[model samples]
Target: MLRKIAGIIFVAGEEGVTLNELAALLNLSPTEIKPMIEEVQQTLKDHPLSPIDLVQFGERFLYVTQADLDPLIKNFAQSPLQQKLSRPAIETLAIVAYRQPITRMTIDEIRGVSSQAMLQKLVSRDLIKEVGKLEAPGRPILYGVTDYFLNYFALSSLEDLPPIEDLALNSQTASEELFSLKRWEINLFDQEE
Candidate 1:
């Protein structure tokens, strides 16, 4: 029962498990489980080699790093900062992420510049790829972001992409306005910092 309780607590991680919740799951009353939880806590406390401790916050019990190992644990668990993507690359990637299975010519038209170099760089980094060819005059290659792109951007999936404000991007005027607003927003953010 102690092992089962400890296993459930460990699996719960930071969210933790309440005594009442555990009792309900195990078909036992809270009173019956209190001693077992106390035993688990004492066993963990008595184990000199153990790097974990059982802690309670309000009615919840959870596993936490033992006090003495905080620095080592923090150092070992630190996540490195991701490399920053270039502005052009980000813009191209955003377009691909939002308007996937799109052609390079269409991308160039949207950005009002050639996207050949950016596309090549994105493909090389495995962030974007030539997914297929558009069935048109020359059968221009269609580009889309890969699963790697989602990972690189820390996105669960393409659906996680932020909604493009004012989706009426049928005209170049609307596109220009959107980019201008975005640049203005960036400036405002920089000023706030």
Candidate 2:
């Protein structure tokens, strides 16, 4: 039961599993799963391999870096960030972020190549999402940067985005805006909405 609970917790990652959900997956009642998880929590107390503890945030739970690991985390954060996307993916993301609610054809026209794969990857990363279908023939999906994208970039709102006129005027290549969703971003996305 402890192993099962731990597996569920790990796979859930920042998106935590509810007690009811865990119980259903384990084929046990919530009452049963609750106490079993309590036992597992106790076992993790003062654990040496991983000092991090499980945290219950209302209906959700997650394991975060222990305070002792702060310096390591800080160093990791200080290092230059890496790109999760290819050049094409970065280009695709910028177009979507700036010209949001834009159709895929528009992105393709700007890039001069089929962007189907890049669009798929952006959607998979939750950086971009299909806001709705466009009014055009075939009603192609309209894409926009997700709340996850906005938070990842540390922008408070869409209004924080630079004007579209600036982007069009600059003709700057679009590599400047690629960012992976950070752990905190994932956590925020996971909370009940």
Candidate 3:
């Protein structure tokens, strides 16, 4: 199955393919095929000598040459996956992801700071968007993570997210230490709702 996936990716070339396509082709759901796709990705990465690499950009998986072997190719462009989110943006994104369909006011309340700019930035980046209006006074807009969010983090779905309890710090100091991380790999989960 891994070999088949590799072959399909190799043949797909720069056009690449999507998990949905793979699942459909294999007569499986995206959840059923995601692990196999990950296995194929891991196999490619485990071999240091292999010049190829598999990367997920949004919803598409493209075959890219290893950076170490870039010189071998005539002209190798950079991958869009190289794009990164800021720490605050990541934090804001995490809040929305975990407690999705939440209002900006709610996010601001949780973060203990105004999330207006962060919300705007996230919306502009297509990472998060207004899902609907809350059925309350003023009808504040609710925010939720987009499909691009899952792809950016290489997550198959919200189901793939770890449990919040696993990441919760018992002490305030420990929580500060965790949040102070310079570069987060986005192993985020839910918070108390």
TM-score of each: 0.44, 0.45, 0.47
Name the regions of candidate 1 deviating beyond 4 angstroms.
79-193
Candidate 2 residue 163 Cα shift, in angstroms, is 3.7
Off by over 4 Å in 3: 1-84, 169-193
- Candidate 2 RMSD computed on C-alpha atoms after optimal superposition onto the true structure: 15.6
Best by TM-score: 3
Task: List the candidate 2 regions with Cα displacement exceeding 4 Å.
Answer: 1-83, 164-193
Model 3 whole-model lDDT (C-alpha atoms): 0.75
For candidate 1, the C-alpha RMSD (Å) to the true structure equals 14.9
What value does the lDDT take at residue 94 in candidate 3? 76
**Deviation in angstroms for 101 in model 3?**
1.0
- Summarize candidate 3's per-residue lDDT along 130-158 as a digit string, tens digits: 89999999999999988877876678987
Per-residue lDDT of candidate 2, residues 22-73 (tens digit) = 9889999999988887877777776789766777889977677787889988
**Model 1: colliding residue pairs:** none
Cα lDDT of model 1 by residue, 58-145, tens digit? 9899999999999987875542212234567667867887798999999999888898888886786667898899989999999998
Better of 2 and 3 by TM-score: 3
Any idea how many clashes model 1 has? 0
